[model samples]
Target: MDPVSGELKLFLDREKIRDCLARLARGEDRRDAALIRASCWPDSTSDYGVFAGNFDEYLAWVVPGSPAIPVTQHVLGQSYFEFDGALDGDRACVETQVISYHRVDFSVEHRDTTIGGRYLDRFERRDGEWRIAARTMLYDWFQDSGVSVDWSQGVMGMPFSAPHFSGRAVGDHSESFFAKGKAR
Candidate 1:
């Protein structure tokens, strides 16, 4: 292949990998099983400390609503990639920084936990599509932000009453927006 075309292929492959990561994050936050499934190969494996298993097991553990963690969000940051070869290859090692927030609902009290971490992933291109083949999550730091916010009162005492726009584990406003075929 020509140098120019090879470079373009590399760029597109990198973007595809990034998109897969974003989709995984969004799926986790929304508890959308399909989106999460699309990000990984059926034979993939994952190790998230609390859970370590195959893709199916991981999906079952995360996609279902957990009473302890009713809400969660994952903010992805810069991603560094290392291809198997000098040019675009079928396999790559990727490390993505992330900040995750979880609303922990306890019988005694409700609190928000923020965690800074990195996802170490091995991406494999199969049938011209890049997806995670293996993944492991590493924690860097964690903070317990005592007491969750009171959404009823609204943000900063400004009565913003729009239950339909609110975010939830399932049936979130984003779902309706996507249902209208607005998403790509």
Candidate 2:
């Protein structure tokens, strides 16, 4: 009956869903197993194009393989939530735009790989806590052509240590994780 109350409920629902997704992203970046386990439901399943599987198997595959890299920013936009008056849990759908770039020294345009995608999520509240029931990642476009790494200099135009893992190496890690599950 009250618009303010409705808005507050939506805001609270959205915030909880956002926080859960953020925690998942952080866990992936840091390769934190505990964080992933805590954020996702025990039976949660993620559909990311070719890679879709249960929680534990996915985590085991992802946690150890991810390499250390530059910072990643996950920008979330256009989130929608629906809660049936009779239902106890909240259902939320969000669109996320993730921009990931790597730079050893200079943060230039050429060194950036822009990837645009949307995250469709369904969250359910259980025991006063929210958990993701199902999630999907939809990629709209991805541009990989970027600046060349100057390996001869061993630095990206600045005095710094060389990258332990190259772009190819990082890619291999991802492929191994996602591909392994698909193979089986």
In model 1, which regions exceed 4 Å deviation?
A: 86-88, 182-184
Give candidate 1's root-mean-square deviation (CA, Å). Answer: 1.6
Backbone N/Cα/C clashes per model: 0, 0
- In candidate 2, what are the lDDT values of residues 1-184, reduced to their tens digit? 4777777766777678778877777566556687678778888888888688888777886676433334333455555565655333355555555544433224453354556777777777777677777778888877654664655466656654544333332333444555578954
Tell me the deviation in Å of residue 36 in model 2.
Answer: 1.6
lDDT per residue as tens, model 1, 75-159: 9999998999868579999999999999988988779999999999999999999999999999999999999987767777787
lDDT of each: 0.90, 0.63
- lDDT assessment of candidate 2: 0.63
Query: What is the C-alpha local distance difference test score of candidate 1?
Result: 0.90
